[model samples]
Target: MPRMTTERTKTTVRIDPSTASGEREALEQWLDFHRVTLAQKCEGLDDTQLRTPSAPPSDLNLLGLVRHMAEVERGWFRRVLAGEDAPWIYSTQEDFDRDIHAADVDTYEEAYATWQGEIARARTLAADRHLDDLGLGEHRTGERFNLRWIYLHMIEEYARHNGHADLIRERIDGATGD
Candidate 1:
């Protein structure tokens, strides 16, 4: 397949319309907002601008967060939901907090692509199941969790990272989160 030449945009999200009612809408909205917010942090930047670390000790950068998040999306949707048993691109069942490695632009692209693909897949999964349906999976512990856990977890993850990206983008080029 030909590689998509079009870059990501804050307004280009591909969320499907909801058939079920209730908190699914809020959860979906949060997910949608964070997706755009995440991309906003990445706006108007070249490779060099993206790679530069945000502040003093934190190694988190816009591109690196994208890389890390992409890995997370893949892990949850492809490996967990689909039960592929594939090793995680970020961490093969290890601590996901350490998945912030983006060595170069190519690495960022790969990671981001991984995330985008998985996001699409996860949305498909969500579309088929109502929010009440059990989404069986495990935490880092041996304990199992349901689909609700996954939805909440992903939203938390994205929101936290979007906060990080807010400061990083501002420092990078006087940009602010919307």
Candidate 2:
């Protein structure tokens, strides 16, 4: 198969989620807003810069966060919601932290591609499902969750990681914003 090229946007354009939209639309738009926010944080950084740790004690970096989010998207939307038995792209159950700790300059573009692909698949899987529909698989606690809960959790997940991305970006080049 041919490799997919992801043309990095110099500056990301994120639309505000509508205030008057229905529950589903509002949730999706907010989730998308946070998604673009994370991408914006990584904009204009090279692989070396992307792989730079936020601090000596922490291995957190923009690239690692991107890869981690890809895994998150796959786990929640594919493995749980859609019940697709999809294998992980960057880590395994035995060593899930591999996604965050294994960041390398060589895997920069591949990480972005994998992340984007997972996001696309996630959107597809959620499109036809109603907000109240329960996922095909249960959460780690063995409790089933609905699409609504997944969207909210994903939004929270991105929001938290995007905060880290913001700090990492600032540490790299002193750029900062929403």
Candidate 3:
């Protein structure tokens, strides 16, 4: 006989994708859901707690995640999509992981603010563009991706990092939820 076990389902207060009426709307809603989920995971935590790493030899933390996402948002929407000459906000050529490994409690407010700002900018950049619209910039492989591809990629990126955020938040204060 096979062993039986109970599976747990976590509760979340994210946007409902089913309510979205179109392809673009659904993508936006899902991305927003992940973005909010990341923010919610970092809520109620002190600066020090937010900066604490998941474990030894691992620099992953909530604060770093916010900074990293801000960089990502800027890279995809501002630079790639808009073809703007925007520079890195947190990372540098010498330290690419500066956004991740250099998490600082003192810059908590600035980091979150930057992330929110990037999100707003991304929305504005994509608002008037169609899904099939190609980006003004090309990927490192010399290929350009469409706005639809960027949206899907961003959603995947946030989803993956949000999983990390869930683990880090749980380890930080025993908080757990989806």
List clash counts for every candidate, in order: 1, 0, 0
Model 3: per-residue Cα lDDT at residue 72: 96
Candidate 2 structure quality by residue, lDDT tens digits, 4-35: 23535577789999989998999999999999
Full-model lDDT, candidate 3? 0.85
Q: Candidate 2: what lDDT?
A: 0.86
RMSD of 2: 3.7
Off by over 4 Å in 2: 1-9, 103-105
Q: Rank the candidates by lDDT, best first.
A: 2, 3, 1
Point out where model 3 deviates above 4 Å. 1-13, 103-106
Best by TM-score: 2
Against the reference, the lDDT scores of all candidates come to: 0.68, 0.86, 0.85
lDDT of model 3 at residue 174? 90
- Residue pairs in collision within model 2: none
Model 3 scores worst on lDDT over the 10 consecutive residues at: 1-10
lDDT of 3 by residue, 1-178 (tens): 2122232233435676777378988899999989999988877776777788988889899989999999999999998888888899988888998998653333666788999999999999999999999999866577888999999999999999999999998898798887
List clashing residue pairs in candidate 1.
135-147
Winner on lDDT (1 vs 2): 2
Candidate 1 residues 1-178, lDDT tens each?
1132344445445454365747877787778768767866776666666766888687877777887887777666555554556566665345555466454435456656776776787788678766655544544565544566677888899989888888888887787745
Which 10-residue span in candidate 2 carries the lowest summed lDDT? 1-10
